[model samples]
Target: MLFSSSSTSLSSEVSQVLSENIPSRSTTLTGDSTQFQINEDLGTEDLTNGLPKKLIQLKKLKNGGTTIKKAKTDLEYCYDSLRLYENPYVATSRDKKSGYSIELCLDNKYKTLMFCDLQLNTDFPVYYDSSLENVAENIERENVTPLQIRGKIRIHIDRDDQALLITSQSISLKCFTKEYACFVDSGTGENTSSSKIIKELNNTEFFESSSYPKQQLKVTHHSSSDQKILLARGTYDYPFTFTLQANTFPATFSSFFGKTHFRIESSTSIMRIPSKPKGFLKFSKNENITDKIILTEEIKVKRVLPSTNMLKFEMFQLRSYNAASDVVVSVIGNSKLIEIGIPFQMILSIVKKDPSVELHDASLAVAQRMAIPSIDLKTMDILPEPYIKKSEYLLRTVESQSFDSDKTVYGFCFDDVIIPNYADGLPSWFKTFYFEASSFYPNYAALKVTHLLLFRINYSKNEVIEGLEVRKTYRVTVNFPVFVGDSDISTSSLLPKYEKFENISDLQDEPPLYSTVTVEGDN
Candidate 1:
């Protein structure tokens, strides 16, 4: 008998199934005058299985390829856990002329990733086309689907030169709620005065466009085509409206009942601007972006500010490097991925820190927004911190300068992105590094450091022609410290306080460790 006096019909059915399935019969029963009764136990009652099944599915997903769901991730978990030749994954840069190689390592721990000493052969021809004729690049693999993870370790090759590059890829891991966002523009030109256009008590750093706090206008339709452009002659006034919804916190706090569980309610509002406001966004097809004239205007804040909440705003700009037509529009989100306009193969780079630069810790120095050029949505790259080692986070994309023989000339720039400092402000260990690279090591090159926030490099045209004639490669390295402020409500600094007593015997019944330990010696 498998049933006890308290057994229900459903339990009896399941018990009968289990009894028939097992090869050997083992039952807890006692004979009765009318029937047999089974003993009840809670341990044998649970029929749910979730853990083992998940592992089995993960194994089945692997199909003779570099499995993304393997026990370990291809990207290192921290900065210190990096390797090159010794590890299963290695990154190498090879010279086209001398056939020499340079090895770069990815450190997962310490947030510090770097390449060892790099020495390139001067005879190889360098390709300067931004189209990537022949340069060794790193691929990022962090978060992906089981199918994508189990697929082959894919490497992209330039059809012209057969040079291989690893693409950058990653996804958001944090949980965030999104809503219908409208009239979102980074603070730029006249958009700066439009803060009153949004009436919510809270403002996000990411506008509909630029991700830079200082940048304000979202450049929507930029055409290099020879079209009649709107010149920046005067400030123009316009009308705009926006609707917003915010997440609400619990009105009451009850720590005794549910310590960890808390619920939040959501509220929404609509804002309309009745007055004509002045702002500027110049439209000229001829002038390069740097030389374009800029106009500024101010708008009035309509809503009242509450003393409790802080209002923060940010702006960003996106442009295309290769084709004149392709443009990328991005908004910074509370989560990992920047809200990009397109969905396609992307080459991503996370601008973190330069380990080679001077600093206590280089990676933490630039935890601000990064500048990204407009790109086709169909062929985009997604790079985040988790996809690579901490040191690699600082690596970003740059437009190649020119192609001389097989050598490629590249131009690199850092964004003027900034994050707000907390009350405890910038940690002592934080630092930031600046770097500039050329086609090969050229003679008489100059680097300009401006505002402690910007950097520029000038090269002698004659020296570039002489030293960088053909296939060659070189990398410039820099480093800086990261700043972190401690917020009052920040969860990073909370711990329980415990008291220590002098005597063990005076206390109540002691634990084994307390009785066994003595100041002088323990036998």
Candidate 2:
């Protein structure tokens, strides 16, 4: 849910917090079964009693098969939601436009957004404690100014539908989220598993993890100046705008158990007004037709946090024994951003050597930790701590490598290693490796995933502290936090640079102390 700038000084401010809740759906369709017969498309099926089925077919036909043809829109999107900072295509399936209907367009297109970068300066702050101001304060719902999104909609009524009139239009940014602890079966079609929660929670029994609506902006309405004009319309164009109060809208993800999402909805109501009999009471009452065109567009939101650890030239070092002397390990890349399909460098050098110390086989690996933050059952807000699940993958290993404290000045750089993108399937693996665009996105309130680069040093040393000489074997580890993001969006001007080094004593900076970094862990 949060990210830090590299150093302690930079990360002192607040961090990003996930928005509270997102609804399962933006709009629901409901109606009474009034048997009627009609034909528009789909080979003329019965017009009554099959509303849901009818809508599905209409959506495919109207939106051209559930996707937007790129030729029609300026926005570009990624096919998968795994990578960060790419526009995501949500539902573009529009209802069939016919008879009396309204079309709502955002920035001129009805495309749903999956990820959007929120630039935070003093303007947008991300908040962690929410007590005092911090770097995250810009995006904090309680602190920052509301963000405005504008769009235009056109209402059209057929010439024959003379009584249909545009009454009022409503626009709102709907931010809501929900979680369900079920009966352990995803297909159960049930939300909360009350029996399970009660059994698991035995401490005086307070259960059910669901949050209330965290942040919301008032619904906005735009109405035509007067209603005296003929209820029917040739065409009406009205531009509407919505302001988003919650800046940290998490990327939308839904499963049987939980959901985090955001959407914008616009509703236009139209009703048929009965006209009094004109030339002398010819006829009486007519069935008044009332309809509302509600349009919902889901959007993805992301917060970009910068860190020096990801820079190529921003070198970081970890000494085996002491901050002042002894063996050292160095990585050529920044600590923050470790990317897949890209390689980084790691080096080992004995800055100072003695016959008492010996270096053996060494290996580098990556550890992945997915932290599903704990939620308060009562408030539904995310707690500070998380329930972390971990898995490890081997990056590269060295069976034998020689390093002399006096001879190896530049240190021994290992073979480049990468985060795998091709090992796509485990349950199903093909003879050939297939590529998947799915890699863990950096941080999310609902599900936060993080990685670490681990350098495991295997060595033996002889010590004579006591009266007798003793030989000892030891495994020392050096780890670095890995933040995932696209390389194009990196804040570092250039990659880490290096200068010629002839001797160990010629190094400029003092030895590095221990580094304490964790995903969403701020100091």
Winning model by lDDT:
2
Q: lDDT tens string, model 1, 350-446?
A: 2212222111111212333211112122332211110101212222223223212232222223343333342334332222211112112122011
- Locate the minimum summed-lDDT window of 10 residues in model 1: 264-273
Off by over 4 Å in 2: 1-101, 108-147, 158-163, 179-214, 222-233, 244-259, 272-288, 306-313, 321-332, 339-345, 350-361, 372-385, 399-451, 458-474, 487-523
lDDT of 2 by residue, 181-233 (tens): 21222133377542213112111111111111222332334343333122343
In Å, residue 471's CA in model 1 sits off its true spot by 19
> What's the residue-level lDDT of 85 in candidate 2?
29
**Candidate 1 wrong stretches, greater than 4 Å:** 1-364, 369-462, 465-495, 503-523
lDDT (CA) for every model shown?
0.19, 0.40
